[model samples]
Target: MDRATWDRVQVLLGQFVYRSHQMRYAGELIHCGHCGSPITGETKTKKNKKTGGDKQYVYYRCARYNDEDHPRIRMTEAEIDEQILALFDRMRVEDEEFRNTFREQLRRATNWDLGTETKNED
Candidate 1:
């Protein structure tokens, strides 16, 4: 096969393998906090009004909604992201260098800078 065709085959094979793995182990992705039932993530895409671009939204919803007894559970991607940020924010290490690196990463992820904050406060 030609190089381009071989590369395309490899990409397709990789996607197929990834999807197969996800299908096999998808049950472990999320679970309902209340009833211990499985949850599935879904995504929706919409166009941005201001930018005229596509934006995707993700959420995890309980799979057992049809059941009468199980309470419904839904979580937005933003909420999950916030929780993850909070988790990273609370993380601490004994090493000073590691702590500084972690802090820098957090600031970068949040688009925050100490200089900007200081200037804003003045």
Candidate 2:
């Protein structure tokens, strides 16, 4: 196959694989606090009577949620996002020395030198 056709085939295959396993935070990002199991995402569609449409919602819950004596706690994606944001907010650095160290480490990790760069006004 030609280069363009091969690239298109690769892109289509990637999209198919992504759609087949569309859970965003299923494996590594979160775990169940109560059961210590990985959290999995699910999508649910609810029919809207007033609007005559279907509203889809994503939720995350423990993989063992179906097991007996589970906590039965399922959180929507929005709730998980809010919790993550709150966590980041709590992780803000107050000490100047620690902040500087963190900034340097982040710069090194990302291989970017923001301090030495100048912005163009034009």
How do the predictions measure up, each by TM-score?
A: 0.46, 0.54
lDDT of every model, 2 decimals? 0.48, 0.54
Task: List residue ranges in candidate 2 displaced over 4 A.
Answer: 1-23, 94-122
How does model 2 score by TM-score?
0.54
RMSD of each: 13.5, 15.5
lDDT of 1 by residue, 79-104 (tens): 44345456555767789898777556
Model 1 TM: 0.46
Q: What is the lDDT of candidate 1?
A: 0.48
Shift in Å, residue 91, candidate 2:
1.3
Winning candidate number (TM-score): 2
> Which lDDT tens digits does candidate 2 get at residues 15-85?
22223124545654677899788888877766668999875556678999999999878875435534543
